[model samples]
Target: MDVSQRLSFFAALFKVHENPTTGMWLLYITIVLLSILVFKLGFAKKLPIIKSAVIYTFLILGCTVLTFLGVFLPVAEGLVVAALILIIYKIRLHQEKKEQAKAE
Candidate 1:
């Protein structure tokens, strides 16, 4: 099969067209959460503007590509879930560090 055919095949495989509304919402939520996370992380490191710019540029590029491929929503949902997990892990680590510091 040709490129278009291959792409469609994969998009169908991922069920991108199954629920457009849900997918759009997922993409929206993913973008919002990612922006917040990036901003917070960047500011925490004292490079808010530069860091958020760099990270968001890549993220938007990736999202655009996925949108074109018709799998943007599913991918965005996965990313959001992963980011939340990472945030939770980071918070736990920070708490543990604080406890250790207090004990010492």
Candidate 2:
């Protein structure tokens, strides 16, 4: 890639300038999995099996677009940070609830 294209951290890391197919696939999978993790940790709610299936379907489809941007941006990195924050929040919330229950 040219100097400008290499500005994408993951693109350079994945050697996209050398191998486009492999790099693109790696970026796509990374983005999709991270997107699902972020969704489950921060936004998902209980639903019927079919409803959940539909939601996942759309989520997977949505990740396709994200994959393109991910190659040129920190999309996966951002999602990772978001997922970590949500996970920490959930852990703290759980602990608070446990402490309250014991006090009660």
Candidate 3:
């Protein structure tokens, strides 16, 4: 509509990390990458380091796009959700490990 609104829209689309909330996004991404590495390392897999790195790169870009779409009321909310997901994943994994130990 107006020039200012147009500019803001474009900024949000391209400037994800410019917002402080993007820190949460980065944290979630880091967690995902680290988890992948841990899994591969545990199994003695070759560790597709290069491929996994690229995958994370694309995922970050995708999240930025989704953030711009107003998908989560200023994007920070999405970051919080991502963090929660990571927490849940870690908790579940810990429980599973405990169960396996008992069985063993």
The 10 consecutive residues of candidate 2 with the worst lDDT sum are 1-10
Superposition error at 49 for model 2 (Å):
1.2
**Candidate 2: where are CA atoms >4 Å away?**
1-7
Q: How many clashing pairs per prediction, in order?
A: 0, 0, 0
The residue-by-residue lDDT of candidate 3 on 1-104, one tens digit each, is 54334333323444434564664455445444543444443333344889767765765566555544442243444344555676677789999999999999
Model 3 clashes, total count: 0
lDDT for each residue of candidate 1 in 1-104, tens digit (9 for 90 to 100): 44334334334444445666665455544555664575454344555788758866776666555555444225444445667777887899999999999999
Write the residue-wise lDDT of candidate 2 on 1-104 in tens digits.
46546446776777766888998888888888888999999889999999999999999999999878877788878988898999999999999999999999
Taking every candidate in turn, the Cα RMSD to the unseen true structure, in Å, is 6.2, 1.8, 8.0
- Give model 3 RMSD, 1 decimal: 8.0
Q: Clashing residue pairs in candidate 2, if any?
A: none
lDDT of 1 at 6: 36
The local lDDT score (0 to 100) that residue 53 gets in candidate 2 is 97
User: What would the TM-scores of all predictions be?
Assistant: 0.50, 0.88, 0.41
Candidate 1 clashes between residue pairs 3 or more apart in a chain or in different chains: none
What's model 1's TM-score?
0.50
The lDDT of each candidate is 0.57, 0.85, 0.51
Error of 1 at 59 (Å): 2.7
Error of 3 at 66 (Å): 2.7
